[model samples]
Target: MKSVTVKNLIDLFKLEVLIGNEHIGRVITRSRAHRPGLEFVGYFDFFPMERVQVLGKKEINYLHKLTEEERNHHIGNIVKYHPPCFVVAANQEGLKYLMKYCEQEGIPLLRTAEPTTEFINKLDMYLIQALAPEMAIHGVCVNVSGIGILLRGKSGIGKSETAHTLIHRGHRLVADDVVTLKKLGPNTLLGTHNESTREFLALRSIGLVNVVRLYGRKAFQEQSRIVLDIELTHWKDQALNNDLELEPKFSDYLDVRIPYIEIQLQPGRDVASLIEAAANNWYLKQQGYSAAEEFMKRLQNE
Candidate 1:
């Protein structure tokens, strides 16, 4: 797993660094945050002290009600575990004790003006994405008709060319040669381009072309939720499956299944147009309309 640090979180959410800059380099592997509700009363059993510790307004106010000696003692016990960081949400008061203990233990102390629930939600989402399982594959991802489609096949199968044509047709290219897919959730996969070559598209005849330069910013997207996988199977001796196409196919990634299909690539085939239709058709199916199923029902009625 690549390193996701406290400093990255600070920069992402614009959190205030109150103390322990040296400890900002701590790695955060846990996606869930720990609120010190139990630890405030000295309950350490089953306490997930390794995750980001968030002290909300209620927790802060509870501590403020305690004596100085008691407050410092409880915070003292909590910070000794040296969690990744202590985030004070809602910019609530009564942080002097927490600051004191965290500074002594060399833990990063962060402050956010956002309310407790909202800030935690944002932080949790970021953590999930940063820590999600990731894989890189050789393909071109594109956003067509509000659907994220991954075009995958062997080299010279026109995956890039189709993506290029789609871009010309007003679709946006996510990645060209290499696309990184992260499992953001059980059913969600985010397809994004590599940072270095995000804007460059490789064509066998024309060489590398900058998508932004050729098609402007609208023609390139940072990331998208991959909803479909189109495998361009070359029409090499393999007969197309007409009957199987009605039920749809599936491809699995990181234990999650995505709607998959095979488009036989023959000479003089308008593969780009087929892909655009595929995107639109998939959207309609999601809205409870399947053309094949509907047509079959009409035949049965007749």
Candidate 2:
């Protein structure tokens, strides 16, 4: 966290300072950051919270009616609160006194041409996300067989449907559609569904449905380690480029490189069976056995 002075803020975002030149040295930063960006836009309304005030043309006009001493007391209370910043919208007429006070206190004064509502709305949106928890991308995630499986697809043939079938097979569901993946540490990547919309699947005929209730609670997982990655793609008659090694290669998603497989989907294909076999195949491979490779070797020997 850091703080920016009024002079710096005036330079950045190029906002005009209508009042308070003395307060140019005030600092601003993240909530806990001792040094804050005075120019920093926050998600919350820091002005009211810090006892800083907003003055538009209307407020300025009303303030003009107060006696000189009353206005001084009001302004004094504001300065005593030690608010780092003050924002004024379209009050150039009343800026002289405010600017003079700001200069003495070293407080930052900000003025914007944009309407008050628009300015606050835009600032809030920017600050909220900037301060929110940060997540890192790892790999796509899917839940299968009570285990979360990360699946990748070029665009869309049947990634969603494959997940649907896995759900119907009594396998618990974790995520659907776009999945957010994060790396927890070395060799461990976590995957989950979109925050706004997860545990839901979209079908061409039926549209969207809740996976948890329709399938069961066991089908939904809040988080899962991305242990395996299966890619669904259009089937090819004969791959011109096949790996001679007949061994699977790994790919990097985020920082983790995961063992991946490409499953080609075609009409009349039992995708569920293929996925299950793929998972089992991976399991067997980890156990130092290859059923498909062994079957090929036996046929060749015959």
Q: Which candidate is the best by lDDT?
A: 1
Which parts of model 2 have CA positions greater than 4 angstroms off? 1-140, 240-245, 292-302
Q: Which ten residues in a row have the lowest lDDT in candidate 2?
A: 32-41
> What's the count of clashing pairs in each model shown?
0, 34
Q: What lDDT does each candidate get?
A: 0.89, 0.62
| Residue 201, candidate 2: alpha-carbon lDDT | 75
Q: After best superposition, candidate 1 residue 108: deviation in angstroms? A: 1.7
Question: Which has the greatest TM-score?
Answer: 1
lDDT tens digits by residue: candidate 2, 194-228 = 67666777766688888877877876777777777
